[model samples]
Target chain A: MKSTWMMRAFALASLFMAGSAWAEVVVKIGFAGPLSGPIAHLGKDEEYGARLALEDANAAGLTLGGEKVRFELVAEDDQADPRTATTVAQRLVDLGVRGVVGHVTSGAAIPASRIYDQAGIPHVTPSATSPKLTQQGYRTSFRVIANDLQQGTAMARYAADTLKLRKVAIIDDRTAYGQGLADAFAEAGRKLGIEVVGREFTNDKATDFMAILTRVKARQPEALFYGGMDPQGGPLLRQMRQLGMNTQFLGGDGACTAEMLKLAGPALKEGAYCTQSGLPKTKMPGGEAFFARFKKRFNMDVQLYAPYSYDATNALIQAIKTAGSADPARYLPALQTIRFNGITGPIAFDERGDVREGGVTLFRFENGAWVAVP
Target chain B: MDILLQQIVNGLVVGSVYALIALGYTMVYGILGLINFAHGEVLMIGALTALQTLGVLERIAPDLGPLAQLAIALGVAVPVCMTLGFLMERLAYRRLRNAPRLAPLITAIGVSFLLQTVAMILWGRNYHTFPQLIPTTPLEPVSGVFITPVQITIVVVSALMMAGLLVLVNRTRLGRAMRATAENHRVASLMGVDVNAIIGATFVIGAGLAAVAGVMFASNYGIAHYAMGFLPGLKAFTAAVLGGIGNLGGAMLGGIVLGLVESLGAGYIEHLSFGFLNSSYQDIFAFIILGLVLIFRPTGLLGERVSDRA
Candidate 1:
């Protein structure tokens, strides 16, 4: 009598769980980024993008495998530290999230990718641009943004061909993103026969670059390329101007943002160029409507990676719908082969899990804003 | 030669700010035998407050001239920082005065972090572009090397403040009281000096110096943020120790020397390191000098003053 009752109780519990699963599925999508530290602004920006995507998808009544699904964002703060990133990734995986949207910086993303790869979860980074991220050969790891290779080549070509500049000085912050972009720029500049003059490095925490600027000034390069984020880029620009070395300044996506303008202020001059990884917002598919909706929902302007992050979330959800299930293992293959038009562009990953034909848009700091270089 | 001269000029400008900040560290250490780790946060607070004041002024009085705006910002920053310093001593440091030395040291660190978090929430984490009141026109007193008006102002202003500080510490009745307290707080108390009030005054004066230094730093660098204080503060502490902790003249001398070493060392590090290290490794100069000074002369360059002799 006791055994029969126990069996019946177990059966009833299973039935209730199945019923709930049938009624509605809550799919958790993980997001890991620096939410609390110095780079928290960028992480928060991407998180908001994912949040908006989730809200829109649920409001539209997303259905996967004939079950109405509510997409949930499980945002984790990696603090932009690589070690913390791995822990965050494991935590998200343990939480049984179907997919992930970010570990914003290349430094954090590279290490976190291993954790996601082991868990067999589809992880999409919206903003990390190191070419090595995809080169790791992880089947589940993918990026929505163009890698540094494209950015660096474009920057080099712009310097050599568009501006007709030959000599360039390179300064990197020595992080994965900064150094990788600088290395790529140097390689491309060398290939184009432009003189790669005075390659220097500073750490990310540094505020002083006068010594490096002075050295770069002595070399008298026609252009200065800094591969770092806005904080360092801003001060470097100011110091460069102070040293009276008014060279054409070029940088990769790290230095290309609205915040850069605020940080650099009057130091930002015309003819300063930067390359971002996607098409201009106006040029993206359904970008204008999305931006309008985003502003209405969040009451803030989109920072650098919001559109890409929005697309990343949508693409993950689309893959779930395509696979007819929210299980990461079941949907990941669908994600690999998924072809969907997204806010940024047509979202399709190549075999290496890099966005196919990822676009690079050139921008110039003009009239106190970043304007597309016509 | 021109590059050397230019780096020296840069060093001196930076060093003067260090001297101003170091004076605060030395003064507090002299009187209380405490490190006052939050001294750097005091600098950060001053800069951020001034920036906020300038922001308000810009919005309310767009037609205000840059000089007037600067004067008003400084006027606001100094008093606010003075109050912050006073409150810090009263609330955080004063309680731990009789505790184990380690207790106060840890509390100082905790106070530093607390201030950073508060400032971060208040000002946001991103670097705000501090308005440039001083023109950045390069004045070439020497060929092939350029110095901005801002740099000159930093040097001149720091020099004037240091001179004024020397006069205050040596001439006034308050100065005598401060010196007596630093020499022997218990004896000075017995001699009718208000030991607590003098300590508070020392913090206020140091905070005032920090406010000016903070403004100069932000103005010279053209950006300001919450974390901006940590590095300058650490370097300034080094300057204080290097100059002999309790000596006013030593603090100024130590700051300039350290600055010159950093500037010249950064310019020549690549050659010195046989092409391995470069200007990017400029931070190493401070640590190296600090280590060398601690090893060779524990009492510091000018010699430390012992407040209590058992």
Candidate 2:
């Protein structure tokens, strides 16, 4: 009787095998960001974007090399620190992830990109905008967002041409990202013949700016451009208003977020401008739909780089499909030339791995919300 | 001239907060001869606790006056920090008192990291927006120079607290006992000083002062985070050492001097360096002064206790 039962089980196994012959492939994509620091909110937002992308791709029944592929996200926290970023990048490479989407800060992304390049793994950063990241000629490094060069020029042109502000003062947090952006803005401002009145610097950890602000106030510039994230930018705005500077405030994408609004509180003045490195949410290919879906899934507003992350994840997946394999060796070439319309905009990389035809959208704080400037 | 005056005002306002925080360091060091590295974490706890309390109060009693909310917040922060200080003394520092000096110093650092981690878990790693209680209007007593009402309040409140602390440490029997213990622990114990209690009380009082300073710091900065205490704590320690590590008045003097140097250096760094250096080099002033004091005058400016002993 036992032999007869075994015979029946063998028959059932044979029937199941005959019905389906394809083996499923799991493609692992690594995500690295500061999941546990002052900017953890932005990091987590990037994580959620990658997670949602994988979920949607899996739901769509993606196939690679004629095998049903299920995309998986391997998330790691770099603490928004440069040293930690290199260590985590090595860990992700050791885990044999096909690709990585992350590194929310320029300081971390630059170092981590070298590690990925050495390991021959493709890394796409959703946020970090320092121009030096791509200038290093690391074939493995790619950026989905516009570099600070594009952003600074756009901001400078808008200030000089639209608002016609001539005299400007600049402040930076003296970080790789902040200094690089501030330098670019200053260069552009000078080229446009705008009189640069003063330049000052502060570290990222500083909470006080009275000494620097006082000196800047003495110049009485028509506008003030700050190159730093929201944590510093918001307080600077508050102090500037308190000191009655009444000058226009502008910054790059680092200061362009709903979190900045909250940080600035009532200090957020009307017509305070920021440049985001993509089309406004309403103007993206599927931006409005993506925003609604993201809000529903996460129960929180997108802080800043979530949509860029979503595009980055999709771009990686598209490259894998274009190569018809999940191996980094096979897909590295495909990634260089892949093009797809993303939630942020068209996704295509230049020779240096920067987004091609990258766009910047200007935003103004009005009535307690960031409204897109036409 | 106006810039110099403005910078001095900025320096003094910032220096006072440093002075308050430095007092705790000086007192603890005076009694125990140990640099309480975790004193900074205590300040962080005070600020974060106050922020959390204010958040809850604002939600439950939105109609409550801002001043009342601030009072309640401080009321919660002070005791909580005091208890934490007491526990730190009793549980961690007390056991290691008889051990090698390095052991307690390392333990203090460990305790500091532990508190920071716990705070991160409880309050989150993001910067919480500190509620504005006082008006933020800048009062320009002189043209081209600005000082806010909040800054004025910080200066006034810290001055009052310093005066109160002076009375507490110099005008009471408990104060006499504390002074005796600090002078010589063994002899003071033999003289019925309750050396252990005096040491414990110093920690509690320091924590209480830190709570007030923490509130003022968060108010002045308009934001608070788990890591907020670190820089201020280090600066305050520098102030303590500059004034003479165990001298209360010395801490105040050191803090003010450090603040002035930092402000003036940042304000004129370009002119000072022929456009090579900039205000970004502001934090370097503290370390430079700290090194100068340690090398040139180990006894500090007004350091009487240690100089007498040495």
Query: Evaluated with DockQ, which candidate comes out highest?
Result: 2
- List, residue by residue over A150-251, the lDDT tens digit for candidate 2: 889889999999989999999999888998889988999889988889999988878778889889988989889999988888888888877777888999
What TM-score would chain A of each candidate receive against the reference chain A?
A: 0.93, 0.92
Interface RMSD of each: 1.6, 1.3
CAPRI tier for the interface of model 1: medium
TM-score of 2: 0.94
- All candidates' chain B TM-scores are 0.96, 0.96
Query: Candidate 1: where is the Cα deviation over 4 Å?
Result: A1-23, A63-67, B306-310
lDDT of 1 by residue, B135-248 (tens): 876776577788899988998999999999899989998899999998888999999999999999999999999999999889888888888999899989999989888888
lDDT score, residue A277, model 1?
A: 89
Considering only N, C-alpha and C atoms within 3 Å, which residue pairs clash in candidate 1?
none
C-alpha DockQ for predicted model 2: 0.60
CA lDDT for candidate 2 = 0.89
